[model samples]
Target: MQRAKFAVTLFATVMAIGLTGCGEEKKPEAPKPEAAASTPPPAATVEIKIGTVGPLTGSIAHLGKDNENGVVLAIEQANAAKITIDGKPAHFTLISEDDQADPKVGTTVAQKLVDDKVAGVVGHLNSGVTIPASAIYHQAGIPMITGSATNPQLTEQGFDNIFRVVGRDDQQGPAIASYLAATEKPKVVAVIDDSTAYGEGLADQVAKTLKSEGVKVLAREKGTDKTTDWKAVLTKIKGEKPNAVFFGGMDATGGPLMKQARELGIKAVFAFGDGACTDKMHELAGEAAEGLLCSQAGIPPQAASKAFLEAYKAKFNTDPILYAPFTYDAANLLIQAMKEANSADPKKYLPFLQKIDYSGATGKIEFDAKGDRKDAEITIFVMKNGKVEPIAVVKSGKTIPFDEFMKSMGGA
Candidate 1:
């Protein structure tokens, strides 16, 4: 009986082992490498191009670079933030083009940007270029913002796609004229323009305003944009002995004019518009820059945000130039529009961008129906000890002292 029980127990144990093996066989197996490969990867990121066109290879290339750098800095910040447009991860691709400050070249560049399908454009620093370029961009339905081009007709042309970050020449022209009448008290102010659309238009406005203020305009001389020889102009102006001389042109031309004016014994206070109010003037004019007064389109650098200054310095290894602040605002304005409209297409976001009231480093940035910046403040800088220093600010044609301007910015 003991032997029989042992055999039965051994048989049952074997059966139990066979049943457990069958149960293990029914379980699911792991997937193979080939099967795993069938799963799709995450969606690829999308790209949107932002065209930057300016005079990247001309006499005022420094100003162009400053404008370009501002846009680049804004793009870098957007990329760092991992910007998403239209529900997809979007990257901003810069399509930079140089027009050599030529209006015809500007039109070609604008068409190229249109053909390249750039979503937006920031550039053509000179008014001569911006005015003609506007039609090209408008035809293609591309929105463009000018940071430096201040010609009023640029906005007055009725182009819905055009915008300007800086104040118009009319605003700046009248403000400077008022300051000159009230403070400079010039008996006769000579006016010289480079004969380009920008230089001529601005000089005309300044002359009109000065004449309106009962200040006599001594000479409305003409100078080509590339003229380095101011011998005749200076000789004529010196003979007149005007109390002040206003230059409506860029730093490249303005610098030589300043140097030559001093060299020719023209001992009058030199005044300049936004086009000539660049930091490059310091180096270009050398010691002749002393006591020179110039007008810029926005608030003084002293009131710029510390964060902006620090970031700009860290990125470019230099301080902001005349129009960089406005350029920064222009770039950010478009990006903010893209964010709000939830689209990267210029046609979709342009209306949003137009209506945007962005408070940038410049000031409260609101656009008029004509695409001009509203409530624009013109900052007047004086060359003191080899640097341009803000002495006063004018808003809506009212001159405010430097101290008072700072206080107003504080909301006091």
Candidate 2:
């Protein structure tokens, strides 16, 4: 009887195991997706080209290099942020060409950018190069925004495609003239230029303004830009014995001129336009750079926006100068326009840029009817203890008051 009971229990356990296996087999599997839904979507890719032309190797190469570094930083930051344009992920591709600060070379590079189908250009730092390069860009229907090129003639031609983020030489020349007349009150001042368009034009404008302001113009002269020695010109300036000397060229000439002027004992509160605003001036002029003055666009370096100062220091391991903020803003303005227009095509973006009021790392950027920024500010720099120091900013409180500033300089 015990054997029979054991057999029954074993049979029941076998039946339970078979029933559990059948229950597991009855469960359904998940369905396979359709072929159309199974394939992965296309990879996201969008490219926008930004071109730059500057003196990568020559006199004033440092300034060009700084400008390029600032722009590159802007591009890198934009990419890391995953900037999008018109709902599409955007990537910035920078193509820089060394124009060597030559007008012909600038024109060649501008044409090359046109052939390469870039959306816009960011440079041609020297006014001498920017003046000629602008013509080609205008013809090619590509817009160019310059940060350092301060020649007023760039926008004076009324090219719809041209714009400047910094103050012009016209504004700078008059500001220096007024400062010399009102602040220092120099009785007699001599003017000199390196004969480049920027140099000559700036000198001439200052002479005219100073003459109008009842200040005596002792002498006006031109200097060679390529020469390392400026003793001959310094001798001429020394012979004049003016109360002050105004140089219209860049630091490449201004430095040597200051050094030679000191050797000749021609110190009379020397001042120049933004061209002379460089640490190299101190190196070139030595002790003569003390109290040297220059007028540039934007606030003092110490007062620069926190973001700009920190990024510049981190990238370059030093302080930034006048043009860095302007370059950063110029690129930001372009990106803003691209976003507003919802297209990278210039034809689509130009109109939007005209009406866009962009607040950038530099300041508030709003263009007028003439393609000129409306509220641009010009800041002056003074050298002290072999360092460039910010002095003051000539802003009209709220807006730049373009018509008024131009009228003050007889440029409107």
Candidate 3:
């Protein structure tokens, strides 16, 4: 037997012996009493709670459910792998709360999570909701990673307790503009938003960029979340004869707009941000979604790490959405940092998380000091021939130059 040194910080040590030499004159070894009939004790189980907040039972229910499913899948994977935390086998349980895409509800849920003493948090699909919810989480010292919220200001507050696995709207919004300028080159564009924080922010960013890129803004309008029929809104845009239309809202609104806009004979290209990429969009828009284009942070689930996809499928029994894989990555990265720090306390894990080079479902995930995903990849998808296909993918290690990006978008 080849012998090697074994160092175990938490428990029992092991000694290996080499039988390379048999001593002919070995002194009579005292009977070792059969090594006290050694037996292994049961592995200790430690409980860690994970909290998630999303629109679990509202217009965005599908998105929330899918994100929760992914996080559940990660917990399953961790359990099967015998994940250890603080030298003890760790098992995670999810505490899910519904925000209904409401910021006030989101804040209440965040406070509830703080009371629950969860080890980490994984969601708040809406940027508007995440913004306020994160404030509560920060004050409580509970670290959270959001997979879907894309507002640039979410982490700009520099709260150490918050992190994002997805790219912010600033990176994705202008990237869509770049795509339009380089490929479609529509002469004029019409823009509309739901008037919510997330919807308006993304729309404003894209509009600023589009105008700078020489695409004329013929009309800009707002629609209510409660309004299902956007025919009037669609009619107004169609008369502008803009070559393209950009919408900033969730599938609940975007889906109906796509269906109505097509029926209204708006021949303009319909493009949206990550908020519109849910599977629900296909169901809502039907055939109208066929030619739509959108942008999102991270690659498609199929393009993510194989282990994550396999594990996700085994647990969720369905293909993941845009944010699911990002959530899984964020959760595992948090776990990795906790283990490496050898502490579940947020303070100890904070610094390690700051410097982590995490290999997650989305790809290599690292963070800047501000808790933004570093060197993120953004993918643009176009619904073609009845399916969404990735048309362009860009990965960069440096923060996108805001001024240059603005200039390229015709906004600087």
Candidate 4:
């Protein structure tokens, strides 16, 4: 009986083990794989081309390069900021062209930019170049903003697409002439200009203002933009013994004229317009640069915003010569208008640009109905310590001391 009981218990234990093994026979259904990561595709990007034209290969190439650098810096900053238009990431591309500061070349460059489908343009530094190039851009419905061109005829042509960041030559001419009349108190002043549109136009305004001030004006003297030797003209003017002499030309020629005037013992106070108002004057004119008076259509380079100055130096490893701040502002104005309008098309953004009131590296920037900068300031400078230092700022017919103007602007 005991043997029979042990056999029955052993059979029951085998059945229990067989049932447990059958219940685990699915083999855990093979470990399931993880779903692939659901990464959204990269955000859609749009390429926007912006054109910049200047005298990239001539005497004023430095100034043109400065303008180009300004636009480049602005584009770089805008890209880094991830600027978007119409829900698409904007990748700005700079298309730089060399105008050689020639109007013919300027028009060609402008056409090239238009064909390239650039959203906007910031260049043609010379008024002569800007005037003709503007027509091309207008025909293409492309907006063009000049940072240095000051000829009033540019905006007077009634093209809504034309704009400038600097004051007009009409405004600048009177400011410098008024300052010269008040300070020099000259009984007679001689006016000279390079035969270019900008130089002749500015010189005409100066002559008019001097005549209005009851100062006897000598007949206009002429020189080409490339005239480096002015000994003949200087000798002729010296014979007249004018109390003051004003040159409406670029520093490239103006500097040599000033040095030659001094060497010829002209003994007259030398004054120049924005073209000659540069630190390079010291290098160009040597010791003769000192005590020379000049006027800039906008504030001095030193008067630009601190943030802009620092960034400019860091990016270019050099200080801004002139008009870079304006160009920088011009480029930003284009981008800002596109963002405001939510479109990169020139027709769509042009309206926004017309109505924009932007605070830029230079200062508050707004446009008049004529597309000229409103409330633009003309700064009178004197060469001191090999630098063009501001002495006064003329804005809206009111003259303010440089220090006072800077304080009003919250410092440079």
lDDT of 1 by residue, 269-365 (tens): 8888877887788899899988888887767555655566678999989998757777777888888899899998888999998899787766678
Q: Which ten residues in a row have the lowest lDDT in candidate 2?
A: 28-37
Off by over 4 Å in 4: 1-43, 102-104, 184-204, 210-268, 275-290, 385-388, 406-412
Candidate 4 per-residue lDDT, tens place, 33-61, comes to 10011112344766688999999998999
Give the Cα lDDT of each candidate.
0.83, 0.77, 0.77, 0.89
Error of 3 at 277 (Å): 5.7
* Cα distance off (Å), candidate 3, residue 268: 5.7
lDDT score, candidate 2, position 406: 34
Candidate 3, 296-358: lDDT as tens digits: 876666666666666777766777865788888777877888888887778788788888987
lDDT of 1 at 60: 86
Residue-by-residue lDDT tens digits, candidate 2, 1-412: 9999999999999999999988666422111121122223324545688887788889878888877877877876776777767776777777788898988888888899998788988887988899889999999888898988876778989899888887766777777777677668888888989988878888987898789989889667887787678888778777777888888999988998888888888868888887788888999879988899887865544454567777889988987754776777777777789888988899999998888887766667888776777756776678989987666566642323334433333321
Model 1 misplaced regions, further than 4 Å: 1-41, 44-46, 184-292, 298-303, 385-388, 403-412
List the pairs of residues colliding in candidate 2: none
The CA-based lDDT of model 2 is what? Answer: 0.77
What would the C-alpha RMSD of candidate 4 be, to one decimal place?
19.5
Ranking by lDDT: 4, 1, 2, 3
The candidate that wins on TM-score is 4
Off by over 4 Å in 3: 1-47, 55-59, 83-105, 185-204, 207-270, 274-290, 297-299, 385-390, 397-412
Cα shift from native, residue 323, model 3 (Å):
2.6
